[model samples]
Structures are given as structure tokens and as C-alpha cells.
Target chain A: MDVGIKIIDSRGAACPGPITDLARAYRNSKVGDIFEMWATDKGVKADTQAWATKTGNEILETREDPDKIVIRIKINKR
Target chain B: MKKVLIIGGGGGGLILANHLDTNEFDVTIVDKSDLHFYQPWFLYIAFKGSKRKISRPIGELVRPGVNFVKDEITEINLDERKAYGSRKVVYNYDYIAIATGTSPDPDSIPGLRQIYDEYGDYHSNVYNSQKLWSHVKNFKGGTIAIGQASPTCKCPPSLLEGAFLLEERLRGMGMSVGTSDPLSPSNENDPTKTGEKGKSRIVFFTPFPRAYSAEPMNKVVEPMVKERGIEVMPFFDVDTIDVQNKTINSLEGDSLKYDLPIIVPPCKGPKIKFTPETVQDEERFIKADKNFMKIPGYDDAFAIGDCNTLPTSKTGVTAHLEAMTVSELIQGKYSEFNGRINCPFDTAYGKATFVIADYNNPVVPYPPTATKHFMKMSMARIYWMTLMGTADPIFERFFNITKPEKLNRKYSVPE
Candidate 1:
């Protein structure tokens, strides 16, 4: 989807960073603002989805590319 | 099925209550609080580093095959193997797992109880993550004092994190930090080191001879504290808190004053009426052998958790690790619990350091990094998920994942 997204490039960042930043972006963002995060922590992808489900946000897409897992999330009003 | 009674619905107790086979054991879980909270998150909440709703009603969380009882336990007749609760209810168990945990006894300390009676977990209970949200929300910058009201509070790294988080909280408010002129650097705890016009100074006090109880962590933390411009006063035992004067007096003829004191009160054990054999000290911390097995005399009883005199840090992680051994011990098996504490220390200015230690080892210095902080954040979710039975058990066994060891039950059940 063609949307203005904030790239939270937490590449090489650890566990909480990716999701913590994602939560922050979700808070600061307007509806439809996508937060795309890149993290080297292998658990980030699964955790991101889990966080999304808990917070009532949507994980738009998750892709594994190169050395990091990339996740895109949409800020939704819960 | 053997009747098992698990006391307290917190960390170690809850984990054991969830994992124990219902088909083989009739387990009953009782706790005073109707609600169960994800406690470790209280650090983030108190520091204003993160805001997430981390609580759930205990009624909803107790899994199938476990009888949940919400009652204030009045007494435990260890000799009779019976626990008495409010409403004159009596419970008999063939086996018991005590995980009642520790407490920061404000009542035992003069002026501290008054402080709580006035401020209500201003530092301690919030640190316990029991009641923290409003405290963190209303917090503004000032001369913040993070001190230990007494010795051996759970999670020694807490105040260090509190100061670090407060530093970040104040700075995030556009406060000038690190410099006396709000621009030029002075020494640690310089009067003009915070807020819009330098309205903050962070002072940390501990009863320990060093910044951390563990010496190796001190080696790493002392320097970091210096670099962050945090002042530390060690070997100071807080005896009296003269709230009227805003000064805490030490037993050793010294006094330190503060505008806001975020202190860890003295940790005291629960008042369970266990037999002398079941407890270690006068405080009633449970007695478990090195392997966290075989509580002397009561062969049917196994104890683990912060309430135990485990010769380790009284932390949720420690209790979680030891729970594995306690469960096996109840089943006539022996499992050695290598007391481990994996902690992440946040400088709160977008930086963190991970501290990994065991019962005997002190933590060596490691660089503050984002990766470690991330792990700390992820751990909370993983822990809760595992407890909820949605996540795999392997998630809870993070460190033990790779250890190719035997899971053997060395002892046979008493026929």
C-alpha cells in the first residue's frame, strides 16, 4: 500500500527497541500512518505481531530480508 | 491425586500452579489480591519510560484444573499441614509450595510508615508495580533522591534505573542536564544540573558499601553513575525519615536531605506460622537446600520464591528459575536451580546495559546498548505469554535453552 510511513530503522537494535518504538510511533501517528521497523533481533517479528494484537493495532506486513526482520504496522484507534 | 496447595498468586507460585499436571495433582491457589499484575513493568511505569496497561484480574487468569481462592491467609499451622484464612476457612494439603514473596516493610521502620501512610508506595510499592501509574504521571522535575530506606530490597538495580529514568524524564521535558550552567559540564550532582533553569539534581543513597550489593556490578555501575552525573552515598543505613525536615537520618550519625525521596524500604518476609524447620530466620523466609529441594522435616513440602532465603537476589526471575526445581522436588525429584538474574539497566536516555549474574558471581561491566534494552522489553511479553499458556514453555527457559543436560528425577516418590 502506498502510504506515508515512519521508518523506525532499529536495525541492530535489541528486543524492546523495535516494539517500543513501534508503540511510540503508533501513539504519535495519525490514522493510516505506517510504522516500518527493521530489527536484527530474530524474535522481533513474532513479538511485533503479538504486541499489535494486544494493542489493537494492525500489522500490515512482515517480511524477512537480509540481516533483519522488517515489520510494517498501521496505527489504529482502539 | 496428591493434594497440593500453592500460596500467593505472584511470579513463582503462579508459574508452578500453571505448569503442574492437574491430572496427577489437585492444586489449589490462594492469594490476597484479586488482581495479578505484571510487576517488572512497574520499573518502566515508575520511570515514565513506558505506559502500558500490564494488569489483569486474577480470576480470569487462573487456568483449568486449578482451584482459585481469594482470601487473606490468617495463619498456617505447619505442624498440622493446614492453612487458616479469613472467614474461618480451613484448607488441608498433602503437599505445599510457598511462594509468598518479600516486602518492603514500611511499618518496621520509623517515619517510613508515616511516609507511606501519607504518600502510599511513593517508592516501594510502585517499585513492586502494585500501584504506580498516577505517581509517574504527576511526577515533575526537582532534587530527586533515590535511596534505600533499608537493606536487601528486591532488585538492587532498581534505584539506579529510577534515577536514570528520572533523568530522561526531566530532560525530555526540555530540561538542561549534565552541565552546571545548563550548558557547561560540572561534577556529578552539581546543583545546576537539570530542568529548564537547572532545577534538578539526582542523588542516590544505598546501605551497601558500594553502588550495588554485588561487587562486580559496582565496578560497572559506579563508573556509569559517574558518567551520568549521579551522586552515590554508600554505607548509609537509613534509620529515621524526618519528613517534616525532608531529611533521612542514618544509624551511623549522618543525615541526607531530599526534596523527593524514592526509596526502597527494608524487605521483610511474610508472617506464615510455619514450623521452625520450614523457615530460615526470624523473618520466616523459607528454607530450601542448595538444589532448592528437600525442605527439612516436611518431606511433602517444597518452598521456593523471594520468600526463601535463597542466597540470591530476591527477584521474579530468581523465583521463576527456582520454581522449576520446587515443582520437581514436590514430585519426589531433585532439580538443581542455578540462581540466575538477567537484568537490563536503563540509563533512560535511550541507552541500556544488561547484567547477568548467578548466586556466586558478580556482574562484570558491559557496555550500555540498545540491544540489551530491547531484550528487557521483550522479556515481559514472553514471560506473560508463557504464563498465559499461549507461548511455548521454551520461551520461559531462555538461558536453559541450549544446555544439553539431563532432566532426571533422582528421588523416588514415598510410597
Candidate 2:
């Protein structure tokens, strides 16, 4: 089965919204499933990294553009 | 004269109503309740057993010219520029400001409301704060767990500050503050591992990875937290509180036993209905420009304070600054809110620190000092006058002094 990466769009959402979206996505995801998230809040970078570190998730990539922040996470554990 | 209608009579609404040019606009404020409460006082009430004056009649705080009406707004007719109230009164306005702020929703977390009701908490109304005070005063020394049920709550640093203050208070009562590993399997049966009984432990469970969300502020606070022996359990986004078991289980599959658990409740936007649906998001937070506080698709409508989806913390300081920005936008003045935040963080022992930040800057925290503590203590007394813009000049000076953006110039200059 070819499963595309799930995309979670949280653009323009404030602090904690991005993290909450990531968590909600994590709940339905299996180990090794990768998800991409987009957020506009500047604090999303720090928040995402912190949340990933504490939750035992892996950040595959983080790219920041002028308009939005894009982050990819691979589920490491439930 | 243009009619200006302000909703919710909160920090932002009251300031906007009072600051508008009364000569050019007929101002009115609509709120469900007549009481204007200084919510920061809830901390003092819970920890210090303070009976300090914190509430005043809304009418007493509203300026002489601004009409203060007691009415709960239910719906807005955008096309007609009319707001329908629960009292069946219709309000007409040339411009409207929605400042109906967020409320603590304990029901958001499973079993949270039950625990909150049973042990008392400081996150809701005055009665709940008083209940927490009773519990704090009568605490016989056990595991006191402070955690946040929601990731976003008003005064983001308040729970951490409460922990520091609580630890100090318990220690002052001759209760030995102990340390325990919350994740240890045997710890639940014996939460406190101190040498003697009646020893207390402060375990702070947070959704954020650090003690403070902002790294710079966390750098300053984490050390203080360790110095005070406050155990911080990071990534503990609360999932449920087992009321019968006296355990709080996190979404991360961990649980901690507590004799007393104080959870900061989740904040939700006002329940009022808005026209054109675009006025508010699915979360019910009003949609507005972060800098101008102006609602999209409407030139004359504005949303400020906790109701708006601003990127800053949900705090009165943010509301006050947004009020100033919206007030300027209404009066044909050119101004932009730089996302200034100047919140006081109480570090116990009669000392406090200021969390100062802006859009382009991370939080810059000063060392905790008695001077800042006194300033925070005096804020409640002067808050009403501030609504009337009586302290505008003083606030301007304070903001300038604490502006993190100006730190380079401040330190670079010769003494």
C-alpha cells in the first residue's frame, strides 16, 4: 500500500495550535508514519522541536519561508 | 457623532471605550455582569490568603461620558450594524469592538471538572479561588501537583509562578518540601520520600518541553525552579484525571499521584454569535489583524483581547496594548501594535521578574527583585484608573524601560 504523508495545515493558528494539531495527528498515526505540518506562528519552531524532543518524536525536516513554516515529523512511538 | 459600541467591558473593551474621543463619538459598553474583576488577584487569594480589594462596579470604572449598560450580547447583524442582546435590547453602532474574553472551561479535560470541584482551584471564579485558599491553608503536607489542562491559558506563566509561590508558602509553614520522581513506579504509593511525614512535594506537569514556553525566559526560570526544588515533568499534556484514584494521567502514558492537584483550566472564546461566520474561527476566536486589531472584511469592526486570535499570550497586558492600537485605528491615527508583552512573573520570597517581549524579540527576563514584586502588587490598585487612561504616561515610560527591542542601545551606552 502506497500511503502519502498526511498533511496538517495549522497556518495562521496561534501558539499551541500547531502542537495540538501535531498531537492529534500522532494519535491516529502508526510508528514510522511521517506527517507534514504548516504553521504561521513564529514560535512554532521552538514549540515543535520541544514537543518532538519530549514526546520521543523525530523531526525529519524544518523549513522556514518568508510566509509560513513547514515541519515534518516521523512518529517514533505511540 | 459616530456611535461606538464596545462589548464585554473587559480590560480591552473598557480601555477602548474610555480612550475614544468622546467629543467625536458616543461610546457605550455592554457586559453581562456589572463587576470588573482584577483576575491576577486570584493568585494572591489562593496562595497568600489575601482579602485585598480586586473588584469594582463596572459603572464605577467606566468614564463619565461612556454609557455602561448591563446586557449580554447574543448576536450581531453585520449588515444592519446592530447587536442583539439577551435583554432583547438592540444596539446600533457605527463602529464595534468585540472584547469578550476567554473563560476557564474545566470540562475540556476528562474528569477535570470533578477534580477541580473536589479539591478547589484558582483558575475560575472568585469562589473557586477562595476554595483553593482554604485548601492551601489547611494542607497537611503531601504531593501538590500543578498542571495545565489546556496548552493555551491566560497568563501563560501563571502556573509556574503559582508553583514557586506555593512551594515557598508551604516551606514557610515549616513543611519540608521534598523531591520525587513522578515516573518512578513505586512513587505513586509513596509520593513523598522525605525523611519525615507531613513533607510536601511540588510537581509541575506542563505540555511545553521547558518550564517556560519561551526559551530565553525558560533559561532564567528553570534554574530558579531547580533551586526551589520544584519538580518539572515536561511533555505531560494532561489527558485525564482519575478522580477516584487521585492520579493525573498524561497523554504520553504517564500518571502522577497527588494529594492536591490544581489544574489551570482551558480557555475558550465567548459564546456570542457573529454574522458572516468569517468573523470568528472554528475555535470561536474572533478573526482580526494582529497589528491593527481590525476585523477582516469589515473596516470599522475590531476584535481585541483574548477573543482575538493574536499570536501573543492571552493576558491583560496584551489586551491593553491591543486596545490602544484599536483605539488609534478608530480615531484616524496611524499606529501599529508591536506585540509588546510586559507580564510580571512572581518567583516567591517577595521577589518577582518581568517577562518582556515583542514580535521580533524573545522574552527578556530581569532577575527577580523586590521592586518588581511591589510593582506587581500595586497594579491591582491602579488598574481601574488605567482603564480611564490615567496611567497612560506612566505605562508608556514603563513599556519603554522594559522594551526588549531597545536592550541593545540600553546596554551599549556608557553608564
Candidate 3:
């Protein structure tokens, strides 16, 4: 809800489903486009971080709310 | 309906397209040829069976309602979710399963294609099985070398089968078959050379350390080679073929001269490009999940069979099981892919050897038996039924057990 951020609701999605949504979102995002994925799947944290690290993106912020893990990623040309 | 497009109509694609729910998904398979041949039958075809009897038209194979396209795939863009074909047809899909499989690129090896073309190396499978027949049939009987070009060759046991069957053929012709290499015996302690010149000699070569990895298989095969007087030349990593010298030099500082050479040329993966990292091995097999579902970086792409490095035997049976797993994963059913491989190796004259393996136990090649020969024949029929989609076997339980689907018929050739 800031200057430029895409909030992806992945609460009910499965392991790769949410990760896939995160990837698809990253695919469509421009440079400096921020993304926050709210995921209920516990594996999403590792998957997302691994994907981001592999694809050369920056993780802006990460925190776990009571119900789901929230991750913030910045789209880098890297 | 989710649109599923599959490339390569060999085993995995054929089985996957048939098993995919026609009601829930629009399945289309794109392949260059309208022919889907049972590959194992190539061995039989080279010996006694006819090519026409083993290969069938692709038009008759796929289940009804599944669309088949006769176009060669030129390029696959995972990011765009599109595959370009030779006919210039561009197709998009919700999901794509690549079962392009491995190919023996003789051209990839310097002078291999030339030597094969010049002398007619028929021991090779996939191609020249028919040509091998003519080569064997016209044989007045000398030395026939069944050797591998490298370690990455798919289905190494099949080479043993070719040697065994051809040895039996030469023996049937009343020619002395030699298993001991007169040129390069393992050591002085090894069996003495048993064949004189002009008699048919069968020296089998491989890059593997042993004839078969498992001890029990070694007990059987080593003795089989010794009994039949066939020679074993292991640790030969051939790099180039000097056809004039009738010798093949190896990358591992080894060389061997041969009369007729059947080289399973160093196999390479399909030429299609993928954008994902760690998605393929250095040799080009797509790295796959145990279940053969979803390339890690891409959302909707998956790979099966020899095209994907699943650590299973790169055989049609492994591809068949992978197809079942793919169906279970996509149709909203649960499945776990563990590496499982079973191959019934036809030894010759209505006899065969059996291998059953998994990730935990690894490769355990069991004893040879006549029953496994019949079992292999039964597999050919099962292959037909699978193509026709008539005898489609499905997973009855979601347990992590390997092939709860074929647990019954499995006992016919139980490990």
C-alpha cells in the first residue's frame, strides 16, 4: 500500500502454487516494483527466498504474522 | 479446461497425453513424426522381428479426443510459455511436459558416423537395427565389437543383450563366440583366450567399472560371458574412431581394434533451450523433481523421461511410471516420485535377465530366467495397450510405495 507494491494473496495456495504466483508476479513486475506475498504454506518462505536469490532479486522485508508469512521483494534488473 | 501441450510423442508424452483427463484438460501433443515405435523392439527387429511389426503409426496410438500435431519443435520459450515448431506453428499452453528423450548423435563424435556408414555397425540400437539385421545375416563370421563410446550411454544392459543375442546367433551358425578379449584381456589371471581367428568373436565394451554394478549380476553376467566365451572390456571411454586403423581410441588412454563395431555413440539431450538455471544437467537432461513435476524456476513447465534427469533408468518403463505421476499431479491427485527402475533384459533364445531398483536399495540386478524373457514380451504388448490407451493402469493408493498400480502384474517378474 506504499508508493509501488503488488500484494499477492497466496494464503490457500499449495507449495509451488504460491511460489508460482510469486514468480508470475515477479515476471510482470518492472524494476523497483515491490511485492508482498502472504503465504500460509510454510515452505514458501524458503522457496521464495531461494528463488529470489537464484534470480538475483532483493528481499526487502520478511515477517510472519499470526496466520501467514509475509515477504517483501524488490524487482532488481540483477 | 486447462490447455496442456506436450512435446515429444515417444513414451512419456504418449502416456501422459492419454492419461490426462480429456474432460478437465485440452491435451495436444506435437511431434515431428506420425510414427511411435516401441524402442526395445529394435533389438528383436535386428535379430528376427520385422520393423513394420514393431513400429506403429502415431495416428492410431493416442486416445480419442486427444489432438496430435505432426510438427517438429524448433524452440521452447519457458518464459513466454510457447513452443515453436518446424512448420512455423507457435503453440501456447497452461502447462508443458517435455519428453523429448535422449538420442544417439553419431555425428557428435568425430568419425563415428563415418565408421558406422562405412562398415555398417549394426549393434547400435534406435537406428540401424534393420541394417544390423542385414549385417548379421550376411556375416561369414569374424569379430563383432559391441562397445560404448562413453559412460553416459542410456540402457547399458541392452548392449549386453545385443552381444548375448548376437553371440547366440553366431553360435547357432556354428561359429565359435569369444568373450575373452584376445587383444586386451583384463589381466593374466583372467580367462585365457578361447577363440581362434575367423570364428565369430563378441567383445563387449563399456565405460562402467564392472559388467553390472550389483554383485549378484556380476556373478551371473561374468559367468555368462565366460561360459559363452564373450570378452568384457571395461573402462574404455572412447573419444575418436580411426576407421582406417579399425581402432577406437578412448579419452581414458585405451584403444581397441575391431572387425564390426556397434558403438552407442555418446548420447546428448534434446537441442531445445530453456531459460531456467539448474534446470538441466551439463549434458542437457532437464533436472526433474522425483515426481517429474514442475521445473523449479518456471511455474507451469515439467519434464519426463530421458529428457529430464530423474535418476531413474532411462527406459520406457520409467517414462511410463513418470507419466502416471504427471497425471496424478495435474489431475489434482497426490503423487510422490521416488527413483524406481525395472528392466527385463532379453539375453537371447527365450531367456532374459531382470533388474529392479529404487533410490534406497539402488540398482540390484537379479538372476536371469526364461520367465523374464516372456515378461519382456508381455511388456511389448503392454506397450501397445498403453499407446492405444486401452490397458491404462492408474494409482489406486496415494501411499509413497513405488507402483502400487502394477503391484500385481509386477510379481510376474518380481525382483
Which residues of candidate 1, in runs, are more than 4 Å off?
A1-78, B49-51, B120-142, B177-197, B276-280, B388-393, B401-415
Give each model a TM-score.
0.74, 0.89, 0.75
DockQ score for model 1, please? 0.01
The per-model lDDT (C-alpha) reads 0.64, 0.80, 0.68
* lDDT by residue for model 3 (B65-140), tens: 8999998887888888888887677899988999888866788667799866654443344457767777776677
Q: Which candidate number would show the highest lDDT if scored against the true structure?
A: 2
C-alpha-based local distance difference test score of model 1: 0.64
lDDT of 2 by residue, B66-137 (tens): 899999999987767999997588999999999999877788788998877876677677788898889889
Measured by TM-score, how close is model 1 to the native structure?
0.74
**Taking the tens digit of each residue's C-alpha lDDT, what string does model 1 give over B1-415?**
8888988888787777777788899989889887777766777766663567776777677678888899877677667889888899998999888878876688766788776654444334443333443544455555666776765466657767877776667656655444352333442444543432435667777655556654444665677676655677764667788989888886545687766667666776777666554465545567766456446677766677778755556667667777766777676676777656666677666667655654333343455677777877777777676565556456447565422121112111112
Which stretch of 10 consecutive residues in model 2 chain A shows the poorest summed lDDT?
A: A12-21
Question: Which segments of model 2 are wrong by more than 4 Å?
Answer: A1-47, A56-60, A66-69, A74-78, B180-196, B408-415
User: What CAPRI grade goes to candidate 1?
Assistant: incorrect
Q: Which sequence of candidate numbers ranks them by TM-score, best first?
A: 2, 3, 1
Q: List candidate 3 segments past 4 Å from native.
A: A1-78, B49-52, B119-127, B179-198, B276-278, B393-415
True-vs-predicted CA distance for residue B38, candidate 2, Å: 0.7
